[model samples]
Target: MNTPLLELQGLSVHYGSLRALGSIDLVVYPGELVTLLGSNGAGKSTTLRAISALVPAHGQILWRGGSLAGVPAHRLLKLGIGHCPEGRRVLSRQSVVENLMLGAYLRRDTAAIHTDLERCYGLFPRLAERRSQLAGALSGGEQQMLAIARALMGRPELLLLDEPDLGLAPKLVGEVMGALAQLHCEGLTLLLVEQNAEAVLEIADRGYVLEAGQLTLQGPAQELLANPSLRAAYLGG
Candidate 1:
């Protein structure tokens, strides 16, 4: 087995008195796509926030075998981790190109940033066409695409995506997943948190089930897909 790019051990989080995540252990290897699935109020989103240090968390978060203690979120971006949060939080008033440029704010390599901008445009031509348009004016699906493209501009080794398929049309969802699949094939490491279990399972190599602040189950994607209880419950069988 390959060494993990990111690892979490006994990870826990709380919001005041409410325990949002119990002790959790997770490992994400390079060039793999892993999905974290659960319904509303589960700690799915919380886990991503914890990794990015957006929320106070307790436990070990190791990246490349080093501790991530005291590493602020902005520093994490420079450390090769990019997060595309839920709700496609694009700068509504900014033009598409400007939004993308903001993602590379920490980067000093101007030539590389320009190359990445072109790469993002190549990956999502709609963004290229709407380069001058305000982010808010785009449709929901288009906005989601732009969000992902913006994150890609950071050139991260590990990408954390939260609910990329939220509120998208079926065709647009398919397009988004297909794009993710292509990125995975090109050796991108992904840790995705999504409510769309079935859709995510189709592309994930393995999955972890989060339920109300704790991981309840985990296994290969195929095995999880074949689980009768999971199908009848979370999967809408």
Candidate 2:
């Protein structure tokens, strides 16, 4: 009933002749955890990219009813949007603390930034242990944690994650996914893109599926999980 936190109507993206996304309409209300599911090249990432103005896009991307046109990606943070891009693109050379500092590059509130930093440490205790280590030295799962924490440093209202579980071992995936679930429980709105449908659906409230740059199906997460076709195609029937 409250104003949706984010909305995309007729959203489309193209790379020259390649149409990465074609007229997708989606909505995320406050305090909901939503999953965007698809195979590679399905334009799931493109949707998040366009929302952040990381790519040239057409149609309307509204943030709390205001047009996001002309709003650059760097500025999205102040609007309570944070993106943890694909790949644990941590500043591998930097110390973990230094990397987190970069996430707040746009802010000048020293006190709040420090508070958030400790809060991140609380979320991922391992990060606190390796706070002085180089990001490159951490394991895959650790890197993923740092990536999410870095984005949290921006203090966003809704977090857009592009494959946070990608390439992690089963055990590591559980750790990272559990952390994400915890964040959602603490009132963080999330729009996630993941290939692990079963794991994601377990924690997500709703879901949307994309195929070849178009939204093919969407509904409650439990409904999608129980769907025969979805199970056969994505959940490995």
Q: Mind giving the per-residue lDDT tens digits that candidate 2 earns over 128-218?
A: 9999999999998999999999999988999999999899999988888898899999999999999999999999999999999889889
What C-alpha lDDT values do all the predictions have?
Answer: 0.93, 0.94
Each candidate structure's TM-score, on Cα atoms with residue i matched to residue i, is: 0.97, 0.97
Best by lDDT: 2
The pairs that clash in candidate 2 are: none
CA error at residue 137 for candidate 1, angstroms: 0.6
What lDDT tens digits, residue by residue, belong to model 1 across residues 165-194? 999999999999999998999899999998
Worst 10 residues of 1 by lDDT: 227-236
lDDT of 1: 0.93
